[model samples]
Target: WVRGTRNGDMRDSPEESPEEQDRDEGSSPSDAKPDVTWLGTPISELGRMPDCGQQLPRLKNVSGQHTVLIRTDLLQNGKVPVPYPAKFTDTWDDVHVKMPWSGMNLFPVINEVMVLEPDAAEHLFGSLLPDMVQLALRASELCTKPIPLLKGGMNHSITMSQEQVASLLANAFFCSFPRRNSRKTEYLNYPDINFFRLFEGASPKKIEKLKTLMCYFKSVTEQRPTGLVTFTRKSLDRPPNWKSSQSQLTKLHITCEGTIEDDGYGMLQVDFANQFVGGGVIGSGLVQEEIRFLINPELIVSRLFTEALGHKECLIITGTQQYSSYTGYAQSYKWGGSHQDSTPRDGWQRKCTEIVAIDALQFRSFLEQFHPARINRELNKAYCGFARPGERSQNLSAVATGNWGCGVFGGDTRLKALLQMLAAAEAGRDVAYFTFGDSQLMTDVHNMHAFLTARNISVGEVYDLLGQYYSSVCKSCLSRRPDVSLYSFIYQQVSSSLAPDASDN
Candidate 1:
């Protein structure tokens, strides 16, 4: 019995009858606004749109309104016979697409004006067309009924089937959500899951990300695995005294290579995400967690219901299947190939893995991160993600994470590492920290942990010592030592705090 199985399947439970589904499907296309259009055309009508003309041919829906436009000859059996413009093709010298014998192909059917170079179209939609259409239809049908929204701050989990994930993604693919396009302050609270943003600014890197996403959709729709996934949010009323506890630290592994997904399988992996949930999934921001979302696209659907994460709130997702393989990081990213996830499932027919998304604070100034309020916020956030659900009796697995806020967020790596250890200690979980090629961080963290372990210091004591250390460091710029690192500062503070007075002796 999995932790969240008591409620039965939360997705596509067949509870809704035909009449209920029809009523919830909303009105016909005629009733929809003129601007509303389908995402792409059916596979049977692939390549119907004229190519290389004065103006691109646009597909119109039944209501005689403009829809998506696609070009078929651009791609055939994964071969890009038509070359792309120099700008877009510069990075494709070594690129190759290995098409499966029989799979679907999808064309970009967008309401907005998009002029595609023949090469770009072939690279994006060459081998994954028909599967995309099926996913789109399934998504639209699921969206007919409102997704049941769970109240935030509740310590419970929701499990979704693979079919449910496809449906949710289809809705995102077509941009069918009513009020998500706007970035206005009023809509800031909602997650942006639509792919329209990615289509706006076309670039080599952006197209590569789009290609990666398309491959993910193809795998999930075609494979249709019977596994299930779960999302759980955990919140705590009070912070735990991590330093004072005598509990041994969970198994710790430090590395400078490998990623969370590839190296940390069967463990509770961490997604260093943005507060808005689906960081840049629908857009072009490809970093740590965004890259993860691209590979395991099923994770994208959580944005539909997930609100902006609070400092004390974190989401733990279990059983999401990885669909694609990617190469490179950030701007240098490229889609490698399709991946067949063979991870074994648990008793409830779900992959026996977990991923926790806990956002680290984005500090404007490096020194601003040391503020007690900010520190406490990060501590709570990490703890929320690491904490196990109260309903489960089993022990929690260790966490796999690295460089949480060091990249785009400009966080101090040493300080962030200490914070993660503290939070993991509080929750009684060990950590597998990947430095991602930062050897200095690996060495520093190893030394710091060794020192702390030798002293048998508890997390509560470390928390107190951090307050004093930061205070001293903040007193005056001239008085503060320029060369002191966070690890050295803590080591010095703890050593002195435990030192005996000569007079008392």
Candidate 2:
């Protein structure tokens, strides 16, 4: 979400499309705004579960207070969102539990965008509501299970049962998470936990999103996986000295086809992230990050406590299994169907998939990125995410990335690619660049990589070259000249730097 204090607007860069955002989406009669001003009314018959009188300090941290709705014990001690009570374990499980009256405390904020079948309630959970309650009883046990609350400028990691994640998310489908839905809610900086917004909107796109979510709940409730998922916050106390490193460019495979999720497997996949990790999945903003989260709803749990990323911090998540499939991006987005992720588990019992979430600076004015400080911030961010803790540079996996933050964030793709290249090279990892179906980008980036390789360019040289480009072209271009692309300028500079002098001739 946009962290602007000027207007109190938490606008997010939920890039609706690659090029442009749909200005305003009108709602049909069914798509009218959902008024969730109340949560006492149960949509489904919920079997009561007792809230044992237990007391523990609610989960709290610098990021913000965490409200685990599935824990009824926390709710008993005035943890506000405890709509109803549920006691799964003899203990409160540290997560406030309430047998959700229904599937989700789906918020009203997304009602304008969410549309489902006329009998959406019966469509998915009709007769299954009781079974859902039983499943939530199982899921509620994770309430007090500590999901490492990721704060800024500190390293943290969370590895837990995939079953626990699915359980917590199942509760999210049922809207007991009231605190995160309000403007002044406790998780003011966090994304909304309730799907109520999408449920009320009744729009086709929101309907599609909800459908995908329903599929996840259906899939897990039927058979919960025993795999583990990990979320690690890597904070770089000292970024590499880019000006002195003699690192060489790692291997690169740029393609105009395929995706980072499916094709770029067994590597470090990049999440072109928002300061708020999940972006606008619960809202109208749908793009790379949102789509990824929808397909793997477990990632959405990071919104539970992941504070907005600091400049030097990045969150690395491993073992997230893709659940559903989809076609298209933003407005053209459509859920394909259930995708059973058969990716093997590592020794950690987590999925083999490794995704690094590095939030790029939203270059409000693309030109604002010309400043070296902006470039430095992104380079360090990428390195913080890419650098492995114990693995040597030789063993560090390649990075799968494309036009990160290049959409509505206004990142110059060329500049971003070079910056990432420099970061990856210094980290001693290779790179896999997905052009996202852009042929020209593929050709240009490939050509640039080839030129740099031929020159046997060192990490420091490339670093200096970027600085020179910013100074010689971008810095002056804002007022005096129309600057050429970084590739063109760098090609000229690197070629000239290696050129033969008259004395040599």
Sliding window of 10 residues with minimal summed lDDT for model 1: 4-13
Q: Give the alpha-carbon lDDT of every model.
A: 0.58, 0.64
Candidate 1 regions exceeding 4 Å error are 1-127, 140-145, 150-152, 185-187, 241-248, 389-394, 478-483, 499-505
The TM-scores, one per candidate, come to 0.71, 0.77
lDDT of 1 by residue, 457-482 (tens): 87777777677666777544444333
> Tens digits of per-residue lDDT for model 2 on 1-505?
1111110001125533334353111100122333421121121221110111112233323333322223223322212222123433333122322223323434432232223344664775673544455555564444443344466765766555566677666556665444555749445555566665666766677877887777777776777566666677778998888888898887777765567777666778888777778777877777677778888888987776677788998888887888787775667667777877777655445567888888888766766776778878989898998886565554455777878777667777777777888888888777777665556566677778778887889989888887887777777766543458778778888778778897987
Instruction: Give per-candidate clash totals.
Output: 14, 36
Best prediction by lDDT = 2
**TM-score attained by model 2:** 0.77
Q: Local error of candidate 2 at 161, Å? A: 1.1
Off by over 4 Å in 2: 1-129, 142-144, 479-481
